[model samples]
Target: MSKPPLIFAVVVVIIAVLATQRYMQKRRQDAVNDASPVRTLQAEVSAKREFPAPNRRSRQREVIAAEEMRYEVYFRPLSGGAEMMFALPEKTYHDMDKGMRGELSVQGTRFVDFRPDAAK
Candidate 1:
């Protein structure tokens, strides 16, 4: 092949690679955006995961992790509609269980509060 044709082919390959990367990234973002609500009362603590300590060195000079044992709460999807599981905290995870079923609050994928069934 001629030098000009070879150079053009290389450029085309580079463009194709870049386009593919962009498309994949968009697809990943869409997956997150499509998720409406990842939490429901019926959701149970499917699993517990350990997380590293939070960065307390902030401008506020405050702390988030009070205990050495940090955990992430994983909620089982309800009716498989959401298809997205979320994590919060150890306290939140323990608050919700199979026996309890009620309102569960989540703030930015973190468990805020869990209201158990009053009837139960």
Candidate 2:
């Protein structure tokens, strides 16, 4: 009944609503990706990078935080289109190098696979 308790309840409710919205959005995106047809494109690995995943923990604890690392690979389609950036598994990310030409399989915003050309 007090103002502090009321404020706290409001904050908790807001957080819960936001979390639910985010979860629903993720589900919707998964469905869209599932329905999307995989497209293979001749693309070159343009770049790659790693960044610390978002975390609320302190900097010292970030070293031990779950999902502390996130990796992304950029591909430039040789046929001419805006380059696409995809979040990929660490192993796959490491397997690609800038300027390596290959077939890039993609489903909507999801990354299917990248096979680098063996000859060049």
Candidate 3:
């Protein structure tokens, strides 16, 4: 083939390869995003209260900073050392104290199915 035709073929091949790569990358990202869970578990280490008996319960009071807003996080550990964090949108850190109670739930993290307390 002539030099011009050979060069044009090479350019077309390169363009095709680049386009395919980009498409594949986008597809992979979309698949990951779709498979990921809506919420994930986060790791936190601090002093907390625990309830040893069935009727009696303890609380862990701490301050949390979220998006320029400060709130209090309270957690009460159950029988098996499992604890749940709780906070209200209208409550501040200073408002929390002993004798307060609430219910909370834990969630998994990332696209992979793992426990809530998995090490980050």
Q: Rate the local accuracy (lDDT) of all candidates.
A: 0.58, 0.89, 0.44
The digit string of per-residue lDDT tens for model 2 on 39-113 reads: 999999999998887676555534554666889999999999999999888898888888899999999989999
Best candidate per lDDT, number? Answer: 2
User: What is the alpha-carbon lDDT of model 3 when measured against the actual structure?
Assistant: 0.44
Give the best candidate by TM-score.
Answer: 2
lDDT of 2: 0.89
Give the lDDT of residue 4 in candidate 1.
71
Model 3 C-alpha lDDT per residue in residues 1-120, reported as the tens digit of each score = 646778899999999999999999888877776775564333332233332222223243443333233333545443344544543343333443444433223333112221234224
> Candidate 3 at 35: error in angstroms?
0.5
The full ranking of all candidates by lDDT, starting with the best, is 2, 1, 3
* Two-way lDDT contest, 1 vs 3, winner: 1
TM-score between model 2 and native: 0.83
Which clashing pairs does model 2 show? none
RMSD from true fold, candidate 3: 17.5
Lowest lDDT block of 10, candidate 2? 57-66
